[model samples]
Target: TKSQKIRAELLFKQFEDIKHVYYYSLELGKIFSTNYDKDVARAKLALWYNKIEEYGYDTFTTVANSIENHYERILNFFVNRSTNAAAEAFNAKIKAFRASFRGVVDMRFFLFRLAKVYA
Candidate 1:
């Protein structure tokens, strides 16, 4: 939508800081989307970290600190872009079942039902 792009450009012009944040987010998306080799992606991620640090934005800085803390596990994505989406979905399903039950009165029955559904 060229019109939407034009409108966004106009709006972005009015807010320089917002524009920077927006573009930086878009750049981060690009870094993930690009099918770069692991080495290149790692380097890009490091560079992105440094760039965000330079901005000194508290929100991005907090995210940077978290990323730094779990950097190794995070970087494992470069291996094959693997994710815990399936595990998350399973957890969600379990939560939904729990919510539906309100509370499990019979522990054995609940375990059997959970095994039937999930195992």
Candidate 2:
């Protein structure tokens, strides 16, 4: 672990760009992890985006563009701090059920069985 840490430190020292990206990503993660109000979150994200734009890293530029594109959807997280986990879990269950049978033969019957089991 110490060796790994030393290696990481050496790499970061050698590559300033990598260090900037890594720290910036961590700062971005911290913004989402905090329980800020929607307005505050918007302001923080805007500030972060501006900083990233000024830095002008290609990776962060692409990420900033995506964040701009999905700004409203991203902000929806602050409304209730919810995610699509339940829907995703249900989808995973369905996929597992289908896999257990190797494949679906009768589409109608498969739906009936899925409803019976899941409902």
Whose lDDT is greatest here? 2
Give the Cα lDDT of each candidate.
0.87, 0.96
Residue 87 miss distance in model 2 (angstroms): 1.1
- Model 1 regions more than 4 Å off: none
7-93 in candidate 1: lDDT tens per residue? 989989998887888887888889878877778987988999999999988878887899789887877787898888899999999
* Model 1 vs. true fold: TM: 0.85
TM-score of each: 0.85, 0.78
Clashes of each: 0, 0
Q: In candidate 2, what are the lDDT values of residues 1-119, reduced to their tens digit?
A: 99988998999999999889999999899999999999999999999999999999999999999999999999989888888889999999999999999999999999999999999
Q: Return the TM-score for candidate 2, rounded to 2 decimals.
A: 0.78
Displacement of residue 57 (Cα, Å) in model 2 is 1.9
